[model samples]
Target: MNGQPFQTPVEYLKGVGTARAEVLKKELGVKTLGDLLQHFPFRHIDRTRFYKIKDVQDDLPYVQVIARVTRKEILGEKHTKRLVAQVQDDTGVMELVWFQGIKWVEKNLTAGKAYILFGKPGSFNGKAQMSHPEFDLYGSEAAQRKGNLTLQPVYSSTEKLKQFTLDSKGIQKLVVGLLDQFAREITENLPLYIVNKFKLMARADAYRNFHFPEDANKLAEARHRLKFEELFLLQLKLLKNKVLHTQKFKGAIFDKVGPFFNEFYAHKLPFELTNAQKRVLKEIRQDTQRGVQMNRLLQGDVGSGKTVVALMSMLIAIDNGFQTCIMAPTEILASQHYQTIKSLVGDGFIEVALLTGSVKTKDRKIIHQKLENGELKILIGTHALIEDKVQYQNLGMVVIDEQHRFGVEQRSKLWRKNVIPPHVLVMTATPIPRTLAMTLYGDLDVSVIDELPAGRKPIKTVHLYESSRLRMFGLMKEEIAKGRQIYIVYPLIQESEKLDLKNLMDGFETISREFPLPQYRISVVYGKIKAEEKEYEMQRFVRGETQIMVATTVIEVGVNVPNASVMIIENAERFGLSQLHQLRGRVGRGAEQSYCILMSKDKLSADGRIRLNTMVKTNNGFEIAETDLQLRGPGNIEGTQQSGLLDLKVSDLTTDQELLMLCRKCVEDIFAVDPQLAAPEHQVLNMAFQDKNAGLSWNKIS
Candidate 1:
C-alpha cells in the first residue's frame, strides 16, 4: 500500500533510479512518490480546443494541426543532435524542429504519417513554424483519438528536473500511481449545516481533486473548501485561546470605587472629566469590583485624557491598602506620567516613587527597599517596574501606557511581581478600531474614552507637494519667530542599507544650513542614538530651550511637548496612515493653534492619496482609526505577532466588519446558553478547538 512505505527514494517507487532520485531530491524536493503527489500546480493551461494551422498566429503559443509528415531529416553531432520534419495540413505546411533530443523525436515521428503537433506557433519566411512542438504518434486508432483538448495543469519544473524529462506528464504519471492507493483522511470539522449552507464540497474529495482535478468546476470547489477551512481553523484557534483564558485563569478583583473615588472627586479637580471618561471609569470600577480579577483595555484617542483616568484607578488601589505601578515604553513617558500625577495626587498620603534602569545605585537601593515594604503607595517606571529585585509589597493594579508596544509575555511578567496577580489596566493612546479590539484583545474587557476634553482645538492638517518646500520653510520660520516650537520630522535618521537616505539626511543638513535662529535652539533625535542620548535631546526640547526638534518617529509616541504648535512631516507618502496620524497627534496638545503639514513627492498611490486626504479631512481619532481599518486591513491594525492577539480566519477585522458583529452576537448567545460549546450543533467547533492547540497549551510565561 502507498508503494511499500517509501524507504529509499530509488527502491520505493517505479521509474526512479538512484541517479534520478538524487536529482529529484536535490532539484525538486521530491524524495518520494508522496512528495510528487503533493507538489501542486501554481496554475493550469486551458487546452479545451486548439486553433487550426490557418487560424494560428505568432502571438498565440498553442496550435492544432492535422498535418502529414512529408519529410524528415537528422542533423548535428551525436551530443547535440537536431531533428527537422516538414509537415503539411489542409490549412498550411510548417516545419517542426527539435534540438538536443533528436533521437527521441526520430523514434516517435515517422515520415509520411498524419499527426497533431501542439506548441508555440512562430514565423519563418512568412510561413508557420513550431519549435520543439509536442506530437502524438499516428496509429490506426488515431481517428477515434481526435477530440478537443481539455484544461491541462502545469507543474513548475527546474532545469535539472527537465533534463531528467520530468515534465508535467511525468508528474501526472506519479500522481496517478500514488492515487491508486490513496487513503484520504476524513475531516469532520465544520457543522453539517455550515457545509451545506456554504455549498462546500466533501472534504475528502476536495483534497483529492485539489491535487489532481478532472475539471475546472471540481478545482474551484476544492479551492473554496480549502480556503474556507484554513480561515475557519485559524479563527477557531484564536477564539478558543480567549475562552481558555476566561475559564482557567483567576484574577484579583478590586471592585470598590467609593473610598478612593470619593476623595478625588471631592477635591473637584481643576479640569472637568468628559461624559465619555466618566462612563469608562464607571465600567472599570464595576469590573474591578467583580469577584474575578479585572483585565481591561482603556482605549482613547490622542489628547483624550487617558492619563487622568489611569491615575484615578491607581488611587483606588492605594485606598484599598494595595500598591500600584504604571509602566511606560520609554523613561521620558514614565517620568511624564509620574510628573503629571505628582501635583494632582497631592503627595504624603501616597508615597510615590520613580525607578528607571539609569537610577543611581544608592537611589535604587532606597527605592527597592521602599517598594519591598509597604512604604511605596504608587510606583512608575519603564521596564524597571518588572525587574526581579523590585518587588511590590501589595501590588493590586498595573497601568501600562501604549500597551501594544510590549510583548504580551513580557507584560505578564509584571503581574508575577505580586503574590496575587495584579488587576491589569492596559491603556493606549492609539484608537483601536472596534473590530480589531474585539479580536486582538478579546480576553480583556474594553472601555473607550471616545470624547475629547473641551477647549482643546483640533489640529488642522494640510498636504503639500515637494515643490512647495521653500514656501513651507518660510512659513515655519514665521511660526518660529512668534515663539512657537516646530517639529521637523524626516522618515529616517540616516541612509538605510536598503532605502535611499538622500531625502531625509539631505533635508536635515539643508535645515541646519538655512534656518539658524539665534535666540532659539534645535534638537535632533533618531534610532541610532543610545536611550540616554535620546532622553537628553527630548529633554532639551521639552524644557523650551529647543524650539525646533528634528526627529523621526522615535518621538511619535513618547516626548509629549505640549508647547509645540507646528508639525512638519516630510515624505509623508513613505509613512503609513496610522503612523502619520500618530505623528500628527504629537502636536495639537496645547491650547494654541496647531498645524500638521504633510509634504510628499508627486505620483501618490491611490491608497496613499486616500490616507493623506483622510488626514486632511478629519480631526477625530476614532474616525481616523475607522479609516485606517478600512485602508490597511486587520494585520497592521491589531499587530498579531506583537500583540499576541487571536488570529482570525475567514474574517478580516476590517473588510469583514459585519461578520465580526455577527460573531460578537454569536459569542454572547453561546455564552448565555452553551458557555463551553458542548451543545450538539456546536460539537464540531468544540472538537476542532480541542484537537487544535494540543501542542501549544504550555503556560504563556514559558
Candidate 2:
C-alpha cells in the first residue's frame, strides 16, 4: 500500500476510513501503521467467565453475561436522545443504556434475542445496570475476536471516541486489520544470535502476540521480548553516545596533585574523609588523568561531602596550572560554597571567589578580570559565572551542583568558554536509583559517595498525623531549650484554595502565636520574599539568633545549619522522598542528635503513606530514592526529563528492574565484543538505532 507497510497511513487501513483515521490520530496519536501497533493494552480481561445477572456486583470492574434482550426503547430525541435495552438472564434482569450514538446502537438491539453483555456494573434502584454495555449475538464473536480462547485486551478509550464507533472494541478491530501484515512488514531488529541467545520470540511473532495472543504463555513471551528490546536498544544507544563523546571531545589532563590539595589534606582538613569520599575522589582522579574529557556524575547524600570531593578534583586541575569553577543552581548555594571553601583552605592557600547576579558590579568586574588573568584559582557561582564577560584563561574543570536544575544548553556554554571542552563533574544530592542512573546518566561515568562521615549520628525521623500538632510543637520547644534551632517547612508559601494543606504564612502565624517573639525569634522565608531578606533570615538562623526557621521548599537545597536539630515538614506527605531526605540532611550536621518529624493529615493515600513511612524508616538516600522511583514511577520523578529514552512504552523502570539490568549487561557485552557494531551479527542493532519504534531516539536527559 506504500513505500513500507509499517509507514503506510492509517487512513489506508481496511477498517479505518478517512473519518475513523482522523479520529484515531486526533484522540490516540495513532496516525501511521506503526503508531497503532505501539499503542499497547494497559490490561487484558478473561472472556471465558460469564456472570449471572443476580451475581453482578458493583465492585467488579466489569461483569460479563449471556442474556436475552427482553425490551428495547429509545428515550428523548435529537441531542438529548438515549437508547435503553432491558436484558434478562436466567436469574434476573439488567438494563443496558447508551447516551451517545443512539441511532446506530438502536438498530443493533433486538428484543427477546439472546446475546452476550460486557460492561462495568452500576446499581440503580437496586437493579444492575451498565451504561453503553458491549453486546453481540450469544456465541457470535462474543470474545470480540475470531477463533481465540485467550485473554481479550482492554484498550483505553475516551467518551469522544465511543461516539465515533472507536471504542476499545473498535480499536481492537483496527489492530486486527494489520495482523496479516506483521510477518511481511515487521523486520527483525535484533540480531539472530541475540534472539537465540536470549530465547526471545521473533520480531513479527512478538508484535502479533503482544496485540492478540493465542495463549497466556505467548503473551508472556511477547512481553518479555518487547521489554528486553526496549531496554536493550536504549542501553545500546547510550553506550554508543558515551563512546562517541569520549572520542569527539578531548579532555584536559590533570596528573599532578599539588600544594593546594596536599596542604588542605595534611594540615587544614576539618575531618577525616570517609572511605566512600576517598573512593569517589580516586574515581575522579582517574577520569581526569585520562586524555579524554571526563564527563562524570558525582552523587552523594546531603552531608556525604561531595563539595569536598569536587574541591579536591578542582585542585588537581589547579595543580596542573588550570583554572576551575563550581556552579550551583542558586546564589545562596554559591555563597555558602564560597564561605565553606574559604574557611577550609585557611585563608589564602588558594584564591577562591563567588560570582552571582546579586554580586555588586564593581566586585563582579574585579572577579572577571582576576579569572581571565589566571589570578583566581577556583570560582564558585550561579549562572553569572557563565556570562559572556566571564572568561577563564585556562578553565579545565566545571563542577555543577544540583546539575538537573541546569539545562543542556547552559551547561554547554561552559564548555565553549575554553578551546577544548573542560572536564565535567555533575553533582546531585538527590540519590537516583541505580536503574535510573544507568538510563538517565548512562553516557557519563558515575561515582557515588555512599557513606557518611563517622561520628555523625543518623537523624531520627518520625511520622505524625495532624492530630499530634501539639506534640510536634512540644518537640520543637524541647529542641530549642537544648540550644538547637528547628526548621519548619511547608508545602505552600500562601493559602491554597485548591489544597486543604497548611501554608507557610499560616504556619508562621501559628508558630508566632505559640512561641511568642522577644525570647524566641523566628525567621519566615519563602520564594516570594526578597533575596536579601531571605539571606538575612537564613543568616540569623545560622548565627543562633533565630531558634526557628519557618519556610517553604526554598531552603531545601541551600541552607545548611549544623545547629538546626529538628526539621518539621508540614504536609510532609506532599513532599517527595528525595526532598524529605534533603530536608532531613539540613540537620544532623552537628554532634547533637537530630530529629525529622513528618507531619501529615490522618487520611493519606497509599503513595503518601509509603513516602512518609520511607522517610521515617531510614536515612539512606539511595534506599529512599529506589522507593521513590517505584512509588512515583520513572516518568513522574521530578528533575528527570520525561522524553526520549525515558518515554518507555514497553519497559517500566519500576517493576522491570531485573530486565533493565539484564539489558544493560547485554549492551555492555555487545560493546565489549564490537563497540562500533561493524561485525555482521551486530549490524542489526545499528539498523535499530535508525528506527524510532526499535530504539526510540536514544537521548540523554538534560
Candidate 3:
C-alpha cells in the first residue's frame, strides 16, 4: 500500500462501517483515512501510573484504578434514569455513575468482572464516585500490559458522535487500526538533508508518536516536527508568490524626488515629521524607485499622523508626473480625507477631486473628464473609486485606509485598472500583533509608525460604575462649559434579549432628559438610519451644532472631532479591548486634556475585568492588541479569518511567535540558494508546493 491506502474512504475501515462513517463525516469532517490521521488530539493524559481507590482524592486531576465490579443497579425512570456500579479494589470501594447511555451500560457492565476505571474523582454522599468514566476489561494478558500505557491521546468529539459509539476512545481505536495497516506507507515530503540539519524525527515516527507516545520527550519532538512542517510550507508559498510577482509585474519608476515633494516639505508641512514617520517615508520612497510594484502595509495608531505621511508619499507620485488615489471605507472618511488633502496642498498647486456615491451626476461627469484628460492629480472616494467607469491617466500609486474592511476581490479590481498594477500602500489604524502580521501579510513589506507627534498628551482613561452617573454628568457639564464637545457611545441600536446592555435610543432619551433642550443639543446616529439622514446628523456634530453625539458603534471609525474632549462608553464591558481602544481614539485629537470614561455594571467576569483594566492602564494600541489576542485568541480578531491564512491545526499564533520567526529564517536561507527550488535535492519541496498550491488562490494585491 502507498498513498492510495490513506486516500481510501473511511467507511471501508475495519471498525467504521457505513452508519458510523456518516456520523463521523457529519460530526468531525473525517471522510477519508488521511483526514482521520490528521485529526490530532487536543490534549494527552499520562496513563503510566495507577492509583489505589483509597488514595483517590477529589483534587487529583485524573486517576486510574484497577478494580472489580461487585454490583450494578439502574435508578430513576425515563429521562431521569441513571446507572450505578459499585467497584472494589483490594483496599477500598468506589462507585461509577452514568447518566447518558444507561441502557448500554446496564447491558455491558457485569458483576465479578475486573476492569480499569479512569476519570476525575468526586464525592457523592460521602463516597468516592466518577461519572461517565472510561473502562476496559482487565483479565486479558494484552489488556493488562496495555493498561500501563505511558500516554493516551484524547480527541475532540461531539455528543452526537457519542450516541453512535464514536467518542474520543472510539476515534482513537480507529486511528490505531489505520496506523497498524498503513504506517509504513507514509512518504517523506521534506528532503533528507533538511531533516538531518534540523535533527527532526522521521516522518513515520512522528505520526506514530503523536498518536501513541512512548514518553514525554518523544511527544515533544513529534510536535516540533509537525509544527515546523506546517509553518515552513506556508512561508514557502508566500515567498514564492512574492518572488514570482516581483519578476512578472513591471512598475512605473519614480526615480526622482522632484519639486512637488520638496516644496511641500520645505514650506507647507504643518508640523515637524517625527522620526518614525520619516523612516517609513524613506521605505516607501525606496519601493517606488526600485521599478517593481510595492505591496506594503502601513500600521499606525489613531492620531499618530499617518495621513500626513500618506500625503507626502502622494506628492512624490505627483512630482514624478503620475496620478494618485486614496480609497477609504466610509463616505464620511473619504470626504474628510478629500478636505484634509485639499487644504494641505493649498489652492493652485494640484487638482484634487472627491468622488462618492452622493456626488451629483453632473459633478461626477466633470470629475471623470478631468481624470481622463490628465488634469486631476488625485482622486479620493469610498468604494466608488473602484467603479468601472472611473478611469485614470497614468495612475501611479494607490493608498487604502483601513484596508481590512475591503475584501481581497474588491481590492484586486483596483489593480486591474492599470496595465501594470500601481505601487500599493494599505494603511490600518488597528495595530496587529507581530506574529499575526507575519502570517496574514507575509507576502507584503510592513512599515509601522509607533511614536506620537510632539505636544500631544496621552488620554486619561478611567473605569466607572453605573452608580457614578451623576459624577460623570458633572464632568461632562464642566467640559461643555469649557466650550468642548463630547461623545456618548452605546453598544446596540435596539434592546436585545441575548445582551443586557443599554441601547442607543434609551441612552439618547436619558441624556436628553438629563441635559434638557435649550442648554444641550444632542445628535443621534445609528446603522438603521437612512444614509442622507445619518450624514446630515454627522455633519451637524462636526460643525459643533450639537454639544453631544449619542450614537452606536457606527461612529467608531470615521468620526474625528478635534474639540471633543470626552468619550463615555456605556456598558463598556460588552465591547472588546480593540473596539474600546478605537472608541477612545475618537477623542484626544486636540491639545485640550482629554478623558475616556468606561461605564459598566459593578459585577464583571474575570475576562471582562481584565479588558477594562487594560484600557485604564495604558494607551498603547500594540500592547492592547497583544492582550486582546491572548484573551480572545486569533479566530475572534477582526478580519483575520477572511484572509484564509489562519487555518492552523497544530501551531498557535498567540504562543508560537518564536517558532514562526525561525521558520521565516529557514525560508530566507533556502531561497537564497535555490530561488525556484529547481535543484535535485530540493525537488521534494517543489512537488509539495505543487500539491499545496493546486487549489489555493494567491491574489495578494501589489
Candidate 4:
C-alpha cells in the first residue's frame, strides 16, 4: 500500500494475510495487486434474481433464496458424515447439506435464523437439496443485495487453494478487494489514437467491468477490449520477430532453375505435378531468389504431394551450386524421403546420401567427407544430422519434414551449418487452419499444396461399432481379395486397466486368428520394437509380403504403402482428430479407392461423435482442421501448447479469429509508419511490449 497501487503485493491487501497470499501466488500465479486485477473471471452469475424454495428444480443452475433454518441434524458415520439443515421460505422448505467442513457448518447454523442461500439444486431421494451452498445471515452486510446485485464474477481455483478457503468465491472476494482499492491506478497500455479509433474502453474500466460489470453489454464491451489488447500485443510481437528476421538475415540466392531441375521435371519426373504443388513451388522459388532467408511452412494433407514440392525446392538449391539437407523426425521417414528423392532424380543427376544413426561408422565417415568436399548434393537424416561431427560445405537450404516433432534448439542447429544461415522450409502433412497458422507460424511465409495428384480417389471414411465387427471383417477380406493390403491400428501397445482400449499385440493375435497366417501374413510394429525390427516389419508390409499390418500410431508417419487401401482404427474414439486424420492418411496413396473405417464402442462422447461425423462428411483437410481446432481448443491441438504460441489469457484462437485478424492488420498499419515504434504515438506500445516480452524465450522457428 505504500508504493504504487499496482505494484503492491497481495499480502498487503485487506483480508489476504501472508499465508493466503502465498496460496494465491502458488495456485493462481497472482502475486501482486496488478496480477489479481488481471485474473479475469471464466464466467459470471446474475445475482439480481432469486428463486423461491418451492421452485427449485434439479436441472436448474445456481439459484439464490431467502429462507429460515427450521431444523438441523448431523447424519452418517465418519468420513461420510454430513450436516443437514432444513431451510424454509414462505413458499417451501429444502435441505442444505455440507459433507465437507461439517464442523464449521454445525458451529455456524442456528434454528429459526434467516439466511440467503445460493447453489445448484440437486435431488436427494426425491427431496430438493443443495450441497455445500453459500449462505450469509439475512439483513447482514454480507448478504447479496436483491435487485442491486449485478454480475458476480467467479474465478478459477485449485484444490490446494480450496484447502485454504480460496475457492471460486474466496478468490472473487480477493479480486473485489484489490479492485476496490486500486481501480483508479490500473493504467492504459494502448495508445490514445488507436483507442479512440477503435472506441475501446480504458484499461481501468475494462478491468473493473470484467471483474464486476454493471450490465451484460458493458461486460461484452470490456471482454472485446481486453481480447483485442491481448491479440494486438501477440501480433505485434510476431510481426516484430518477422521484421527482425528479414532485415537481419541474408540467404544464398538460387537465381536459376537450372538443368538439374528442368531435366528432372521433363524426363525423370514420375507423374505430372498438381496445380497446388506448382503454386507452392513457385512461392518457394520466389523466396529463395529474393536473397532474404526463406522461412516458409509447407502444409499439405496426407497425399497432397508436399514431398515433391520439398524435393523441387531442394533441387533449386542444389542447382545454385549449394548443398541441401532434409531433416526428418524419425529414421523411417528420413529413409522414405531419401529413397523417394533419389528415385525421382534418377541416373545420378544429384549425389544424395542418407545420414541416420543406423548408418555404419565407415559410411558416416564417407558422408562427412563427401559433405565437406561438396560431393554430396543432398543429405537426408534424422536428428543424427545435427551432430557436431556433421559439417556442410556451402549448405544453402534446409527442408524439415514433420517439423513440429523437433524442438527449436534442434532445428536451429541446421541454421548454424552455414555462415549465412541456410534458407529454411519446414513441411508438415498436418493441415493447419488459417487462424492457427497465423498465430502459431505468423513469422513464417506459409505455402500450402491443397490438391492431390490426378486420378487419386478421395478416401471414404465411415464409423463402425463393435457389433459390426463381422461386417468389417468381410469388407477387409474383400479388399484383400483384390490384392490390396490392409492396416489395423490400435490406440495402445499394451492393455491398461484404466482404459478398455484394444492393444496392438491383442489386435495382432485376433487378426492372425481370423486371417490364418499360412494363407495371409500379418506384420506387427509399435514404438517399443527395435529400429531394425520395425523397419523389417514395415518393409514386409510395403513389399506386399504381408497382407495386413497390425500397429500402433508409430506407423502414423513415414510408412507409405499404396497397396494398403483400407485403414481400420480400433477404439477410434480414444484417438484425437489429428491422430485419426494422420492414421487415415497412411492409405489412399494409389489410384484405387481407399477407405478409413473408425471402429469403436456403441456409445461415444459428443466430441467423439463430432470427430467421426466430420471425417465421414468431407475429405478436405483444411475443413477438418478448422473443426479440430473448434473441438479441441488451441492448447490441445498438436504443437501450439509446446511452442508457447497459445499462452493466451483472454483471447481464444477458435472463437476470436476475427479479433486476431484485426489486431494483425492494426500491427501492420502501425509498423508501416513506425517500423521500430520510436515515434511518440507508439511509445505506449513500446513500453507495453517491453513489459510483456521481457525475458521471454522467442526462439521458436515459426
Per-residue lDDT, model 4, residue 177, is 76
Instruction: Write one digit per residue (lDDT tens) for candidate 3, span 586-663.
Output: 999999999999999999999999999999999999999999999999878887867777767778889888989998
Model 1 per-residue lDDT tens digits across residues 163-244: 8887776765555565555434345566687688768887667656776666789888876675565445544555555567
Question: Which residue pairs does candidate 2 place in steric collision?
Answer: 251-293
lDDT of each: 0.74, 0.85, 0.87, 0.86
State the lDDT of candidate 2 residue by residue for 370-472, as single tens digits: 9989999899999998889998999999999988888888999999999979999999989999999898888889999999898899899999998899999
lDDT of 3: 0.87
Candidate 1 ranges with C-alpha deviation above 4 Å: 1-102, 105-180, 197-199, 212-221, 265-279, 343-349, 429-442, 445-451, 493-509, 528-533, 602-672, 679-702
Question: Which portions of model 3 show Cα errors greater than 4 Å?
Answer: 1-4, 17-19, 59-61, 68-90, 95-115, 120-125, 130-139, 144-148, 493-502, 692-702
Per residue, candidate 4 scores C-alpha lDDT tens digits across 1-702 of: 112675678899998999999998988878877677777799989876788988889998888888999999999899879899999988988999999988888888789999878889998888889999988888876564332357888789899999988888788777777877777766677889989999999887888888888899999999998898888877888888888898999988888989889888998888999999999988998898888999999999988988888888888888899999999988889988987887778765779999988899999999999999999989999999999999999999999998888988899999999998999999988899998998888888889888889999999998999999999999999999999999998886345622423356667778888999588998988777687898899988888999999887888888888899999999999888888899999999999999999999999999999998998898888999999999989888887778787867788899998888898999999989888899998887777754532212234325
Better structure of 3 and 4 per TM-score: 3
lDDT of 1 at 618: 93
What TM-score fits each model? 0.78, 0.90, 0.92, 0.89
Where does candidate 4 clash, by residue pair?
none
570: Cα error in model 4, Å: 1.9
Clashes of each: 4, 1, 0, 0
What's the true lDDT of residue 557 in model 2? 79
Candidate topping TM-score? 3
Which of the two, 1 or 3, has more lDDT?
A: 3
Q: Which 10 consecutive residues of model 1 have the lowest summed lDDT?
A: 693-702
